[model samples]
Target chain A: MAEVKLTNVVKRYGSVEVVHGIDLEIAHNEFVVLVGPSGCGKSTTLRMIAGLEEISDGEIKIGETVVNNLPPRKRNISMVFQNYALYPHMTVSENLGFSLKIAGKSGAEISAAVANAAEILGLGDLLERTPAELSGGQRQRVAMGRAIVRHPDVFLFDEPLSNLDAKLRTQMRVEIKKLHQKIKTTIVYVTHDQVEAMTLADRIVIMKDGHIVQVGTPLDVFERPVDTFVAAFIGSPPMNLINGHIEADHVVFSDGNRLPVPPDFTGKLADGRQVVFGFRADVLMPKGHTLAESGVVTDLDLKIDFAEPLGSESILLSTLGGKEIQARMHNPRPVNEGEVLTCELHLEKCHIFDASSTKNLRE
Target chain B: MSKFSRAIRDHAVPLALIAPSILVILVVVLLPLMFSFYTSFTNYRLIRPDTLWDWIGLRNYQRLLADWDFWVAFGRTILFLTVALNLELLFGLGLALLVNKITWGQRTLRTIMMFPMMFSPILVGFQFKYVFNDTIGLVNNALQSLGLTEFAIPFLVDRWLAFFSISFAEIWMSTSIFAILILAGLFAMPKDPIEAARVDGCSNWQVFRHITLPFLMPFIFIAMTIRSLDVARAYDVVDVMTGGGPAQRTELLWTLIARTAYDDARMGRANAMAYASILLSIFFTWYFFRKLMDARKHLGAF
Candidate 1:
């Protein structure tokens, strides 16, 4: 295993730069996931590290050696593509042992390594079947097994679970996490799925338009997103931003309703300056005489547009003064469409962003 | 009665549209095939058309069995087919591999390679005939001028050289057919499996041997089967170059059959020989098709 580092790496295709200068450090045995939307250059970055793509500028270091000029075969890195590119003609055993055989290992050694990988992946019974006969999930396992048999210095996954069904994706996600735990190899995974990034990454690098927006642990990016994009991207049932202005030391909405600002925002804001108040749906609750009564509460009278019952909690899609907002409520409350509902926003948990820059005010 | 009439009424227009094609096939293809089969059983001659009424009762078959000239032509045809088809396949596959590597000027080179294929087989035969002439030819003159040979080489007169000369002309005229077809196969191959093999840590040669070659097998056999059928009926080049002369050293089955049917006016015996050669074509086509299906099944497309 080895730590991989990229120092101001840039990728350009004929004068148009696709991957702007990126700097990252991945320690040995760390599971770092580059997560973003499509065309975000996450895959390019992973391919550069795997030596599949050339770095147009800057240097990439694997362990202590610069690998910018090294080919993929000499990089000691194994990649599992999203399509699970198993050789269609070879049986699972041959597929697993291909790298070892190419490296000039003896037949006995190759078979021993293949057998060990098969046992770990529960692929012993499938060793004789070609990839054409295997299902998608089994093919994925064979692809992983091929990588495992090599015992390469690094494992790279480029959206490896993107092709599976949702339930299988979740199952494989857990399996991959468990496998990483067992092997503890340095892994650089790329995906557009935020949930996978949250669950699988030791540290998540959020990117947009080929630039790294933020790099932090999942919860760090979740609870303390540095900018609006990270704040909106990191969570499902995403954080809501409401347009408002500071008036009389309180945030006043466009509809002229006023709410108390958190104590930390008082000195940072100028009077009559526009701001966006950010809050996650789960942090808000129905007005009641419990914690809502004790904590600093900002009231909102919202008209319900729709409600999605998610078994454990219901997501309420409602409008406050013509602005759409989604709130998660825990109680099994019966609410009708177009009915006015009074909810409490926990002021202490609310985040404030400057209207122009969209950066978190607390940061 | 009314329902039956209505069903017939619905089918009448479509069947009417196909009537000309059916009539053409029956008049053109089926009539000739039936006439030839009938002639195979009779003692028919082109000059004496009245002899078509005679029932030969396997006289032509008996004669062919004992005829050393006919059997020699038959054996020579088989040998020519085998050698020419195999050589064409080798050269064609080499050409396809080379053309596949060329990224620039590929279209121009492809057009230039097809120039030979566009020429008539008779033209190619005449071109090579003059080039390999024993005297007053380009090859003999060049060799004499270079002082490589003191005597004019008997390219069209000697047995082995004559055979190779005819086969070479045949291969030159048809090898591009194999190359074009195999190149199409190469272009249509999926890039995913090759990339997968590379990521599996396979060297370039290993990837080609294990992945690329197996996928191209059906195409190779397809080209072989087509060229076999084509080369077995080799006549135009042989007729022009040597005229199956110089002691009939380069005579193939079709040349001998044409000589009998048209030149000697023995249509009945020629038809019998043709029916025999049809077996060779059938065997090759059937074998290649079966192998093609197996390859498709292996590729998981079946």
Candidate 2:
């Protein structure tokens, strides 16, 4: 295993720069995933690391050696493509042993390597079968087997599970995680699916518009998002944002109602300044009469528009001060559409951002 | 009408549209084939049209059983077919590989390569005939001027040289057919497997041999089958260049058959020879098709 480092790596196609200067360091034996939306240059960065694409600028180093000028074969990196790319002409054994034979290994040694990989992948009985004879999952296993036989320095996976059916993708996800754990090799995987990145990555690099937005542990980026973009991108049924203006010691809503800011946030704000308030859906709850009657509760009256029952939890879609809001609650209460309800916000979990720049207000 | 009758009525329009084509085939192709087979069983001669009605069963077949000239042309035709087909495949594959490597000016080069194929086979025959002429020809004149030969070389008179010349002309005219088909196959190959092989630490040659060549086998066999049939019945080039020549040394089946039926007025013997030559074409086509199917099966297709 070897640590991989991309120092100011850049990729350009003609005059268009797709991947702006990217610097990333992947630890030895770490599974780091580059997660982003489509056209976000995550796959381009992975291709550059694999030597399939040239490094237009800066340097890439594997361990202590610079590999910017090395070919993919010379770099000793194995890549598993999205389509499984199994050789259609050869039997399973031949496909697995092709690289070994090309490396000038002895026939006996090549056979032994292929046999070991086949046994590990549960493909021992399929040595004589061509790729066309195999099912999709079986073909995926052969693609992995082809990579495993080489025992390369690093493994590059370019959305490898994207082509499989949903159920097969889940099973293969676990299989790939287990394979990485068993091999203990440095893996740089690229995928547009956030759930896959969240489950498989030791550290996730979230990208947007060819720039790395945030690079941290999955929970780190989720709980302490760097900006509004990350706040909206990381979670399903994403974090909600409501517009308001800071007025003295309170933030006033659009309908002329006011809620007191927590004491910690009192003196830090400027009056008459516009800001956006953010909170996760799960942190908002139905405001009880005791809190409401105390006259000190920070709550908003909302008109419930719809409710989506998700078995154990339900999502309540409501409108507050002419802005849409969603709240997740575990207790399934029978709430009618257009019914008015008051929900209390948990101040500790709420975030505030500048309305103009969309930058987080947290210190 | 019942459902079956309605279905037949629904298909009647298409069948009516195709009826004229079926009638044309029956009259133009099937009738002549039946007439030739009938004539092969009779003592029919082209000079006497009345002999078409006279039937002497197996007389022409008996004569063909003892004819050495017909068998020699048959053997020579087979030899020519095999050699020309193999050479065209090799040259075509080589040209495809070289052209496939070129990224710039590819369209221009492809157009240029097709110039030879655009020329008619008869025209290519005349071109090569004049080039290899013994006297007042460029080849001998150049050789004599360079002191390679003191006397003019008789290219058409020598048996081996004449055969080689004709074969060369045939190959030159048709090698592009193989190249174009193989080039199309190469262009359609997926890039993923080649990349995977490269990442798996395969050399360029290894990737081509283990992956590229096998994928191209089906295309190569298809080109071989087509060119085999064309070369087996090669007539225009050989007819124009040698006309079965001074002593019938360069004679092939079609040339001999043409002479027997049209010149020597023996339609019965010519039809028998024609029937025998059909076997050669059928064998090559069947063998190549079997190989093509096998290659596709290996590639995981039905």
Candidate 3:
């Protein structure tokens, strides 16, 4: 296992900089996932670490060596591509043994390593099958097995589960997590799916527009997002953000709707500061349908436009200050359209952000 | 009967549409093929029209089977086909690999690469004829200027040199066909495998041998199958460059057959030899096609 350190890594395509001098350090044996939207430089960052793409400036270190100029093979890292990238002509055993063969390992060593990897992935029965004959999940397993056989310093995954169906993707996510645990190697995974990042990451690095926005543990980033983007991106139904301005202990919306400042930011903000009032759907619950009764709660009347029942709980679409907001209804009951209900806005769980900067003013 | 009529009625429009092509093939191809088969059994000569009806079954075949000159021409043709096809494949694969790496003006380069293939075989033959012409050719002139040769070397007249010159011309004209097909395969190949191979600790050469070449095998074989057919029926280039001459040094089956039919007025023997040479073409096509299928299977099912 090796700690990967990217010190001010910048990737440029001509004068247009794609990954703009982002720095990150991943600890040894850490399952660090780079999560972001498309064109967010997460994959680009992963590729740079893999040495598939050159870092335009700055340095990337696997262990202690500056691997910026080293080719991919010399970097002593393996990558699992999005489409599995198994050699189509080769059987599963051959695909697994290929790296060892290229390394000029003895035939007996190669077969032993291949067999060990196949056993790890439970691909023993599929040793003779080509990639075309295997199912999507099996191909993914072979791709992982190929990486495992090499025993690289770090494993780079570029959205490895993106091609599989949702069920298979989840199954493979667990498999990858188990693989990481069993092998105990540093992993730098890139995926657009925040759920995958949240589920699999020991630490999640959220990127946007080639810049890293936030880097924290799964629960850390989930509970304490740095900005409106992170706040919206990390959660399932997203945090509810409504535009407002502060006016002497109250947040006032355009429609003259008012709310007292959340308990955390009671006296920190000055008067007449334009702000964004944010809370997750979990924090805004129907009065009796709340999960916890310990937080500082405020009961407010709101009209439920519709309800989306998801078995045990339902998300009730409602309006707050002319902006559509969602509130949770735990142990949900069917609600009539346009029915007004009292919702408990948990002030302790809420956040206030500067309107223009979109930065969370939590500190 | 009703099912048969229904099937005919169901396919009536397509059958009608293709009827013209079938009729044309029947008249132009099948009829001539039948006539040639009939002519091969007779002692026919162009000079004696009445001799067309003189059936001499097995005589022409018997004479040809025993003819040392004919057998020599047959052997030369086989060797020419094998050498030309193999050389074309090698050159084509090399050219394709080189051109596949060119990213700047690749389309322009591909177009330029195909310039030789654009020229008709006869034009290519004539072009190479002057290029390799013994005394005043570009090859001899270049060699003389470079001090590679003491005097003018007879490229088209010397036995080995003549074979090399003819084979070189044919390869030049058709190697791009292989290159283009192989290039198309390169374009369609997924880049992920190569990247994976590199990340899997493969050198540039190893990546090419273990990944790129295997991926390009099916395309190479397809090019082989096509070029083998075009090369096995070799006539125009050798005829134009040396006329199978310098004492029958470069005589191929086609050249010998043409000379037999026209110069010696032996239509029956020529037709018999033509039919026999067709077996060679069929064999080459079949062999290359089998190789193509095998390569495709190696790459996994379609």
Candidate 4:
């Protein structure tokens, strides 16, 4: 296990810089996931950490060694690629033992290591089969087995479960979590899937446009997103952001309707200050289905445009202050399309952002 | 209706569609093949038309079994095919690897890589004939000027030198076929496994040997299959450069066959030799094709 440190790391392709100067530190055995949208430099950062891509500036340290100049092999890191990247020509045993064989281990030693990895991955029966003969889940297990045999200081996963089906992804996610628990290696996994990041990461690093926007626990980032970008990108259905301007104790909408500022930020703001109100679907439940009974509750009747039933809960798509927003309905029942239901807005969970800069006023 | 008639009627449209192709194959391929097989058993002479009908039976075959010169040519052809094909594969693989690394102006470099293959085999023969000429040739001149040799080398005249000179031209003409096909394999390769290997503590050479080369085996075998057939029945270059030689040192099957058939007008004997050469070519093609299939299966591509 190793703690990884990235100091002002930047990546550039010719004159075009993709990953801007970014700094991050991952603790020993910490499963830190770098989550962002596509082209957001999450994978680039992971590749830099893995020594697959050279950083343009600054340093990367793994444990006590500065690994900026080290090749991936010299750095003692193993990466599980998104595609599984299993050597199709080799049998499962050979694939698992490849690193040991490459390191010039004796035949007996190689076989032992191979057997151990196969046993760990429950691939004992599939050892003689090539990657082509295995199912998608089996191939993924082999990819992890390949990584496990190395027993490197850090394990790098580049969207490892993205290629699997949803059901497999979940099963593999649990297995990966279990693997982390067993091995306790520092893992730097990159993915655009927020669910993966939220579930897998010890600390989630939310990045945008090559910069780390927020780095905190999954709940920390989710409950308190650093900005509107994080607020939307971190949660499914995303946080709804409605624009308005502050006016004497109330925020006035474009339609001239007014809403009292959530008590925490009340009177601390100047009048006529433009702000964007943000709230997640969970925080804006219909009155009878309020998520938090203790939070400052503000009621508003919202005309439901559509209802998406998702087992026990349904996401109600509605218009608020002429802005389309999503709200969660607990113990959901079929309601008329145009029904105006009063939704309880948990003021403690609602966020207000400065419109011009889009930064959370709380920050 | 009869079963045969009903079968024909049932597949009438398909048979009618393929009729022209079948007719073309009968006229172009099958007829000539049958005629050659028939001539191999006869004392058929192109110069004396009456001898074309003479039934020599196994006389041509019996004479061929005893012909030391014909056997020598056959052995030399096999040697030439093995040496040329192997050397081409090695050089072609090296060239493809080096070219695959060239990231800038790769299209232009790939185009330049195919220059030798673009030349007709006849032209390559003539070009190398002049280049390796004992006097007033590029090789001798370059060697003399570079002070590597003091005298004319007699490249296309000496026994082994003549063999080398002919093989060189054939290899130069066709090595790019292997290079182009292997390069295609390199392009189609998923880069992930190579990266995974690198991270798996493998050196660059280890990655290539254990990963890249195995992946490229199918392409190499495919190229080998094609070039094996080409070199096994090699004629044009050997014919132009050595003409089966000063001492028959560089004599391949076709050159000896052509000389026997045309210069000596021994059509029956030449036909017998030609059949042997055709069988040799088929054997090489079949062998390499089998290897290719095995290699593909190893890669799980089948």
What Cα-based lDDT does every candidate model obtain? 0.87, 0.87, 0.91, 0.90
Candidate number 2, chain A TM-score: 0.91
State the DockQ of every prediction.
0.44, 0.64, 0.71, 0.68
TM-score of chain B of each: 0.94, 0.93, 0.92, 0.95
lDDT of 3 by residue, A1-363 (tens): 589999999999999999999999999999999999999999999999988898999999999899999999999999999988989889899999999988989999999999999999999999998988989999999999999998999999999999999999999999999998899999999999999999999999999999999999999998888899999999889899999999888999988889999888998899999999999998888888998679788888989999999999999998887899999999999999999999999898899988899999996
Model 1, span A1-363: residue lDDT tens = 599999999999999899999999999999999999899999999989987789999999999889999877777889899888777667789989988988899999999999999999999999999888888899899999999898888999999999999999999999999999999899999999999999999999999888999999999999988877887888998888888989877888888777778866767788998888888887676654123346666677777788888876788898654478888777557778887778888777788888899988897
* Cα-based TM-score, every candidate: 0.89, 0.90, 0.96, 0.96
**Can you write out model 4's per-residue Cα lDDT over B51-130, one digit (the tens) per residue?**
98999899998988899998899999899988898999999999999999989999999999899988888889999999
- In the range A65-85, model 2's lDDT, one tens digit per residue, is 899988889998898999888
The residue pairs in collision within model 3 are: none
Q: Name the regions of candidate 4 deviating beyond 4 angstroms.
A: B145-147, B300-302
For candidate 3, what is the DockQ-based docking class? medium
Kindly list the per-residue Cα lDDT of model 3 for residues B178-249, writing each as its tens digit: 889989999989999999999999999999999999899888888887877787778998889999998999
Candidate 1 Cα outliers beyond 4 Å, as residue runs: A244-249, A271-275, A289-297, A320-322, B1-26, B62-67, B101-109, B134-154
lDDT of 2 by residue, B1-302 (tens): 59988897999999899999999999999999998999988778988989888888887878887899989998999989888988988899899999999999999999998989999989999999998999987799999999999998888879998898899999999999999999998998888998998888777887888788988999999998898888888999999999988599899999999999999999988998888888999999999999999999977542
Interface RMSD after interface superposition, each candidate: 2.3, 1.9, 1.7, 1.7
Per-residue lDDT tens digits of candidate 4, residues A1-363? Answer: 589999999999999999889999999999999999999999999999888899899899999999999888999999999999999889889899889988888999989888888888899999999888989899999999999987899999999999899999999999999999998899999999999999999999998999999999999999898789999898888999999999986888887767788887987889989999888998889977655478688888888998999989999999877799999999889877999999888887888899988899975
**lDDT (C-alpha) at residue A21 in model 1:** 96
Native-vs-model 3 lDDT?
0.91
